[model samples]
Target: MTSTSARPRLAAGQTTDKDIASFLAHTEPVDALAQDGYLAGHDGRAIAQQLRRPGLVRALTFSVCHSARPDTDRFYQDDEEEAAQWRRRRTQTIRDHCAVCPVRAACAELALRDEDVHGVRGGLPEEKLALRLATDADRLGKARAADDRVERLRSVRLDAEREVHRVALMHTGGSVPAAKRAENNDEVRTAVQERDAAKKAHRTENGWTVAA
Candidate 1:
């Protein structure tokens, strides 16, 4: 806050005085993020104020910047434990304030757009928001990464299987046919089998009887 005070404040715009002065006088490239499909949705103007106010949003972002995973769980994890209990109590206050707020989407858009912003954006703040963001971002990242890896590995496995099928077709009149070989190379079938194998192993290792 003290650090940010020197940054340029928003000039009164053509709209009402109540509208938030921009958080950044000029929206820097670093400050802008992929908000097209990212924000969870909320009122823009009202939410923007919460973002502009420096306390909870700033505290949570700072915590995430220092965190190992750059995620919201850092808020609850308590490295900011100097005032951990106080911080948790403070979260409720932020929530109460946000509850009265009419601009939750604006807050969410600001958070999503600014990579620097983390944790809960609107009605929630700090660890409450952080935990959800971490879960969502982690799940999305993991799934996308897994999909890429699966695609690459699928090509490798399919090429190998094709070679075997080709060799069989050449050696035996009908040992392995082109149709079965073609079906095995499919993305859905291979991915499903791969997922199943991984799940089975995970379940066994975790001592679970059901497949994940």
Candidate 2:
């Protein structure tokens, strides 16, 4: 039997920019950064989701110093550079909160899925790299686990291979044989490793650290 994921479902909506600006301006912040004079997660999503429905990302989000980053719209508290540096460190504060956050994966999927998320969002530049690296590492781990299972079932590899074949044929609307599965496994492993290596190269080019 197939099992369903219990994770919260993504919803569709068309929140507008005006609605967002009004939302932020009118509603008071309720998150940790509230005392520091900043909007929270939903606030960030409220603005992004106004343009895209899946814009609801829950990263450790907060504003930075007006001077340190140089593009900040306004000051967080004081005009001092020290205050800005304190604001800069707020990124780590968000990540520390994310360590305990229940929906970290869902939050990250939202950001990565969105192509326009530049600058600081949930965490700092490097902190976001860490989150994304952790995510990629997790997915790769699942793939590796599947590989390990096939290795351990060396004797009954045919049986497991047959199941995979049946499922693939059913999805592809074609015939397939477990007897031919051994060759297919080798091909799949090659393709996966190549793709993974390419991605790693790209990550390195951009200076984003990928996990092992």
Candidate 3:
């Protein structure tokens, strides 16, 4: 039931200038978004120009995905048939919107560079984007490096969170009974001291030499 003319004319794993221009022409007018502060200091054309950059564009004021359903529905659900139905609908919606988007190339580029991105972008889903990366050697290498950096940052965040939780538990003396909260003895005192020491050490690591 779809029109052949509406399909994107992209080559395998490629987005040409012509393709970008064609889709960009279909993007929503930015005058209202700009007035509402979504565009901020940048004009629509300026934002469109940045779509060619390798980096993700922070200003997605004109992104078609904004009007679509949330990305979560694309995932498998308790009902297999229902989930498939949703996925098909979501994919079709993405294709329709992306085919006409002026920033489709940029949207796809962002999806390629960042592994954490989800849902439909650049008229394709994450799985399709992954396929594109897998088939391109240079792009695959770049994506691997980006994935490594993302994993490293995530590991650092998890470690910091765990340390914070440990310190909190130490300060609270490991969740003692309510009646025992007021009955602080040697064990509680030792825990408090350990918590304070840990806090001081953390501060020192961050260049806060002066003890509070």
Candidate 4:
């Protein structure tokens, strides 16, 4: 008896731009394929599912970025004079690699989903990607929500500091015992870090900073 795989087969000439886009719509972000963002123990199931989808295999099989430089940070350089040189190189990459890629549509869809935060994806640079996302109503709503969370976290941080101070003042020596002081300090530190993280998240939602 012969055993067969259950994966659906890709139809001939079915890897059109629309097909690629539709395939990516059902898949996760392709950040796992990036240079700086590669993780060792990523959820393989997602990738397996992507491969089993319509056009992902054909779209990425010979894509150019795969053979380009592994260090993707240059794609997100600041717009200084020095960075202009890198920008030119980035433009060349878009022209030479991304422009001719068969998966450009899929890559663009990923970028539109806010997946390609650090560099060029779908032939659009980080700046262009941010501008596009900024115009998206869904992205705007999420950014506003992030801003509110940052404000709330800031208030919690301030309250934590006051509590730390109050606890310290409860002692006649104008400070809590060593053990209690350490605990209070930890609480304040955690609160401050949480606020800072929230601020970072707000920046990410607005595309002001690269998501780590």
Strongest candidate by TM-score: 3
Number of clashes recorded per candidate: 8, 1, 3, 0
Model 4, runs deviating above 4 Å:
1-58, 67-81, 138-212
Best by lDDT: 4
lDDT of 3 by residue, 1-212 (tens): 12455443445754655444323322322333223432222233334332322223533445555545345354423355676677777767665666655446556655565543366666667687778656654854654564455445545555655655655554365578766555444445555665566555443332222222
Per-residue CA lDDT of model 1 for 1-212, tens digit only, reads: 12344444456563543333223211311123112211123334333332322222432332223232333343343555667675775566555444444334445434543433454555555555455456557543543454355445545556655655554444334565777666655644556565556555433332222211
Tens digit per residue, CA lDDT, model 4, 1-212: 11225323346877764444323323323443332221111222223223222223334444556655445554655557577687788887677766665455445544454345457766778787777667765744553455456556556656666665665455445455888777767766666666576666543433222222
Q: Which stretches of candidate 3 lie over 4 Å from their true place?
A: 1-55, 66-84, 140-212
- Name the regions of candidate 2 deviating beyond 4 angstroms: 1-84, 119-212
TM-scores for the candidates: 0.24, 0.23, 0.35, 0.35
Cα deviation of 43, candidate 1, in Å: 10
Better of 3 and 4 by TM-score: 3
